[model samples]
Each structure stands twice: as structure tokens, then as C-alpha cells.
Target: MENIKFIDQNLEKGLYLVSTPIGNLADITIRALNILKKSDIILCEDKRVSKKLLDYYDIKVQLFSYHKFNEKESVEKILEIFKKNKIVSLISDAGTPLISDPGKILINEIEKNNIKIISIPGPSAVTAAFSLAGYSDDYYFYGFLPKKLGERKKVYEQFSNLESSIIIFLPARDLVSIIKEMKEFLGDRQITIAKEITKIHENIIKGNLDNILDKIKTVVLKGEVTIVLSSEANKNKDQNIDINKEILDLSKKMKTADLAKYLAKKFKFSKKEIYQKILIFNKK
Candidate 1:
């Protein structure tokens, strides 16, 4: 396609940061193919995955492991090649390198060594998830979810009251438990689960956490999941909510505290936090 123009134009210079498909191999871009075809070498998270993709396109460019474990070690060898004025492309197992993947160290090394860098940006699971899930662009990406519970809480506290979407990558095995935890901790905040994207089983489920958890249990999900959650909607409730008016409105049919709790849940805040703020704000 016309997207290959930039690659041909700059084929002679720089460290090419190539992006590959997250799932479907057909998703690879022409410019990325051109860079890989002309590259001096490729650094990959896994040699086998890169080899398979390279084999599909019949690209004979050499590839070597440059993931987290051996990234530091590869830096010297990579810099040595850069000295020869040869361009290299860095790729990961899936998606773009250094985007919640490896090759970050190598990129840093290339820049530090003053090797010019050019990017062949393409398919990214993060952006794909957002597009397929209809997620708001105003968001924060955790890159990947924390496996540890304590770390999760500390992370949750940082974004608990913010007003933007939260996106996280999770493996299939941990999806259920993580979804359950979010529901229990964050209330009925809207969440979208995009699974097996671009594959035969590709699916997207958007709804409250509790309902989404039930749906997953019914189906045997077999791949990575992209989680997106809507942030607080009616932000600045105390300042903007018109406390007396809201209390009067909902109180006509529901208890004041209960209605406050319900409204708080809708915004992904805890009932205690909302009620306490309401108590103080009303007093003031």
C-alpha cells in the first residue's frame, strides 16, 4: 500500500522500530516488510516467533534474542552493528516492540549511541482493544496488570477518583479473577473485555463488571484479554451535583444515603467515600 512509501524513502538510515500484527499475520504492513527485508538484523523477544513471521514473508534477515533477560547483553553487540552504519529493526513476539513489550533497552541503547531511529508503526493490541470496545480515547494504559494484590491496590488508589478510562492487558488464565476483583472493589463501573481479537473467536463484551464476569464463565475464553473501564462520569459531584436538589429529587422515591450510594456506584466510587463527602459538603 501507499504506507510503504516512508520505508523506501528512509530505508538507508536509522534503527527501524517496526510494528507487527498482534494476531493475524495478514495484518503486517508493506513498509514493515520492506524494512525487515533490508534490515541488517532484527532483535526479537523470541527468535522462534520472529522466525515464523519472517519465514512467512521469506525474509532471510538474521534475528537474535533481545528480550528482558538478554537485553542488556545484546546492547553492546547491537551498538557494534550500529557503528557499521547498518540499519536494524527491533520487533517483539507480538505487536510493537517496547509497547508493553521488550526492546525498550535496545531502543534506549540505539538513541544513546546516536543511531538515528525511524518507526514503522502499525497494529497494536492496545489501540485495537480501544477501537473494538468503543473505549474513550481519554485513558491510561497500565501496559499489563499487576499479579500481586498489594500492588494492585496501590495502583488502584492512584486512579480511583480520576476521570478517564483505564486499560489493562491480562492473560486468559487470570481474566476471571481480575474481573471479579474489579467488580468487588470498584462497584458497577462499565467495563469492556475484548478477547481473541482479529482471530476466529474474536469477541467484545461491554457491560457492568458483574454481568461480564457471568458471561465469561459461560464461555471458555482461550486467549489474551484487553480490559477497559469507564471512569467517573458525573465528576465534581459535590460542586456540580446540587446536593440539596439531588437529595430532594432521589429522596422523593429512595432513602438519601441509599440514593447517594447508588449514584456513587454509577461513578465507580465507594459508597462510604461518596456519603462522607456528601455529609461534609452539605455541612459546609
Candidate 2:
């Protein structure tokens, strides 16, 4: 156990967005532990969830509920604490804050008051998944994919053309369906699915979309899954594409959404961005 004397007693009166362990309790850093122990107040996404982490360390501080629903109300209270030069630490239920979690709005409000913000970074799902997903020179973090089938397909379509790895957080319940759609839109692209990372039942599966689909057909996933799709799209992408000519030819024959999906897969451009272009072309 690390001593509390290591913690800086002079921590400024501001918000500290601290990163907690995603699954394993031991993954918490010494510095992070010290901050949690030393902070005057801890603002957690959920008190029950955060209590587990705090109980494990036997370090208790003033905890307040400041999640998405009541963040607006919490801000004024947080500011009052700051005025008294109290150290405030913000932590998510798990992993880092503001990554598919609340804290963006709170941070913006904190900055308005010229409060000092510190980052006590530790464990994160993105970096953890990437580490297990093998080597990829470039990667894009899409956070969470759209829940609706139509919107999700468009998202898969837009990113399918990228020559860089794509990372996404998806519910385990929707894993099979999402993988099926990926196979349809992204072809047999290689992917890595890391689930329950750092936990006892940690599973990391890596294969093409078809391979994953077949393997997951029988098994039921229990936890949220983080996916990493390796890039193998095109070595010579958009080099032969004449944007205007292709738009002119396809625009007349295809619907706007269809055209956007087709062009996104073909040119490696964003489906949503291409759809915006299609709208302008129709007006013209």
C-alpha cells in the first residue's frame, strides 16, 4: 500500500478527471489512488459503482452524484466547493471519463470559472483493446456505434474504406448483428474483439468478420465489447476516382442514401459527409 504522504497536499482547487480501472482493481495506479485519497470531494458517475473501488482501497472521501441526468444541478454545487478551495476529483463508473461517458459538460463549466484541471490518467479500454489487437500503424476511435440498424450500417459503410484501424465500443447483445453487418459492408476485414478486459473472464478474439460471426453464433457475450478492425482496404485508394464524374453518374441512378453508402465504400470517405455532398448535388 502506498502512503498518503506521497500525495500533494497543495492540490489546487479544481476538477481532476481521474481514470479508474476498467475491470481489474489492481490496475489502478499509485498516483491515481493517492489523488482519490487526497481529493477533498469525489464526483462519481454512480455512487454505488464508485463505492466498490473506494472500498477496495479503504480510502473514503466525500462523494457526490454527478452523472448526465443531474450534472447541470451538480455544477453549481461543484463551484461552491471550488470557492472554498476544495479539491474535486471526477471519475467515471469505469475506465476514463468523457470516453462514451459523462464529464464533457462538467469540464466546460469548470473551465468557465478558470478552475485548474488535472488529469490523473491510468487504465482505459481504448488503449487496453489496442494493445491486445496486434499492431496497426494508424487507428481511429469511433467510441460507440449507432444503435439503429440503418444508422449503424451507414457508420460501418463510412469507415469501411479507411486504410487505418477503427476502434468501436459496442454492446455484447448487438455483437453478432453488428458483425454480420460489418461482413456485408466491410467485406471479410480482419477484426479484434476484446471483452471483459482485465477481468476474470477476459476474452480477446481476433479474426475476419466471417470468422468472428461463426465463432460467436453459439456463445452468448456477457459484457460490452471493444472492437478493433485492421485496415486492409486499398493501397491505391481514390487515385482513379473522379469525384465529380462519379457523383454525376451515380447521383442520377441512385438515391441519396444509397449513393452515399456506395461512394463511402468506394472512395473511403465518410458516409455522412458524402451524404451532405449528395444533398448539395441534388439541389444543383
Candidate 1, 1-284: lDDT as tens digits: 23334344546667888999888888988889988988888888888888888887778888877888887887898888888888788888888778888777777777777778888999888888877656555888887868799998777666566678888988878888877777655655778888877777777888777577777776676667888887766234463356446655555577658877776656555554556556655565
Clash list (residue pairs), candidate 2: none
128-192 per-residue lDDT for model 2 (tens digits): 99888875777889998886878987787678557688899998998887887776666556788
**Model 1 score (lDDT):** 0.75
In model 1, pairs of residues that clash are none
Instruction: Estimate the TM-score for candidate 2.
Output: 0.79
For model 1, how big is the CA root-mean-square deviation? 4.6
Task: Give per-candidate clash totals.
Answer: 0, 0
Per-candidate TM-score against the hidden true structure: 0.83, 0.79
Worst 10 residues of 1 by lDDT: 1-10
